[model samples]
Structure formats: C-alpha cells, structure tokens
Target: MPHFVLPVSEVLVVADGWQAEPDAEAVIHRAIATAAEIVEADLGEAELAIMLTDDAGMRTLNSNWRGIDKPTNVLSFPALPPTGPRGGDNAPRMLGDIAISYETTRNEADDEQKPFDHHLSHLAVHGFLHLIGYDHEKDDDAEAMEALEQEILAQLGIPDPYAERMD
Candidate 1:
C-alpha cells in the first residue's frame, strides 16, 4: 500500500566518482518500501520521495538547509509536524524527502567493506526513520533507533549493519 513519487530529481550524477549498482532505482524503491513496512507506516495514504544525488548536490543542500557547508551521506526533510494527526483519508500524506549522496555512500561502503546495495539500503532505512521522527540525538533514542534498524535489516536478510562498529 505504500506509494512513492519519483521526482524530476529522480537521480542525479553530479560527480565523476563511483558508478551505481545495476537498476539502482529498483534497489532504492525496494529498500524504502521495506523500511516503511518495518516502521508500520500508513503508506496507504502516504507518499515519500527519494532523491539520489552526488556530493555536490548534497553539499548544496547541507549548506543551504543545515548551514554546515559540507556533504553528508543522507538528509531527511519531514513534511508535517510529527505530533499532529496525519492527513485525511484519500489525502496522501507527504512524508518528506530523503536525499542521499553517492560519493559519501560509496566511500562509506568501501571503508566499511559492505556491499554497495546493502549499505545503500541501510542509509535509506536510516533516512526513513528520520522522516518518521526517529532521531539518534540522545543515547536512549540511539539505542531504540539502532535496535529497530538492526531488526529491519535482519528481516531483509541483511547482516547486522552496526555489528562491525559495536563496542
């Protein structure tokens, strides 16, 4: 029941570095859908957008929105106030946008020695969690979020994404 909108901003190759996996969009779509399912999102009347871009595009977004002036792996913009009731029936809720930088994602994948698709899927889930108002800004929040992420990723037959970094 999850509905998604592919923007004119579908995918942007603004850098000359890494090439993406074959049918990359398909991988993203599947991951996003899986994340929504794991979060029990009311996807029947909700719409989400995912923008695949490079470091340059992401840097611009980061500078303009967060004032950080640097590229990060993913950025999430939630469309509605999380405390309020969702949109009415038949009105598709705008869940906001998730922008991912190919440069950062690929570089992190290489550094972590994880498969590109798996890493990308993890980022998508992370960003989706942010869209749903989940944040890791606190230790308790981090624990909850990480546990949910591990469970979700496991259901996808993916290995524990945080295991390598666990203390």
Candidate 2:
C-alpha cells in the first residue's frame, strides 16, 4: 500500500461559496491515495490541490475549459502529459488540481441513492484517474477505467458505483 496520508494542509476546502460536509477532506484524500496505490504511482513529496466549490464555480470552469456552460460534479486538471514515460522512483509528480462542486455532488448522490461519501470517493477516483491519463472517450476505455475505479473503490470499502446503473 502506498502512502495514503494527505496532510490536512495539502487539501484546501474552499466551501465559502458552498456548503460541504465536514468529512469531505478525509474522503477526498482516501480516494486519491487508493488511486495512487492502484496505479502504483510513486508519490514522494508529491502534492495535490483540491478546491471545493459549487455549481456556479463549476459552471464557469466547465465553460472556460470544456466549453460547456454547465456544472459538473468534478473536474481534473492534470499536471503531466498522458503519453510520456513517467519519472524515476525518486521523482515526485505533481498530480494536478481537482475541483468538485458541492451542489452537483450532493444532487448526484441524492439522485443515485448513493451515500454522499461513497459518491464523492467515486468522483475523486474518477478524477484522479483522469489526472494519471485515464480517459473514457471510447467504449473499451470506459470499461477499463470503470473497472479500475470499481477495484480501487472496493479497496476503500466502497460499493460499486455503477452497480445500480449497470442493468
């Protein structure tokens, strides 16, 4: 198991613009660390940034970066390229930033009838995978990514996020 410790300082919970559960930070760190373990990523001295915002902020970001003026649950901005070879064992990789919208996430959890922490963990895993060069742009890719997510989440004691929708 990789070092899953996410120092409280490494995460920035910006909930002034939105309301997030008190346990959001813990769930975020656990999700990301689980992902690092799944990918065998060496997280030596590496740092990650998480900004907890709401629908307005997410909509702005989605429009600015993805050209879709809508609020999504999470967005990942990877600091490294997906195609190149990774660094050595001693090297630390800046995983990049993950912005999560409280409103969207809460709504999604309610709609899916999933626990908030579980859904948040799933999104964090999903976003971390994107940072590490995972994509769901095609059917095969989606399957592979989702499988990885399910495995990773299971390690975190979380149920399959897609189980309800797989039917």
Candidate 1 lDDT over 28-58, as tens digits, reads 7777667766777554456677877889999
lDDT of candidate 1 at residue 118, scale 0 to 100: 88
lDDT of 1 at 45: 53
lDDT of 2 by residue, 1-167 (tens): 33553322156766663444888888888888777777775445566678888898899999999999899999999886435766466454567888999989999999989899999999888988887779999999999999999999999999998898778
Alpha-carbon runs more than 4 Å astray in model 2: 1-9, 17-20, 42-44, 80-91
Task: Kindly give the number of clashing pairs for every candidate.
Answer: 0, 0
Off by over 4 Å in 1: 1-19, 82-89
Residue pairs with clashing backbones, model 1 = none
Q: Using Cα atoms with residue i matched to residue i, what is each candidate's TM-score against the true structure? A: 0.82, 0.84
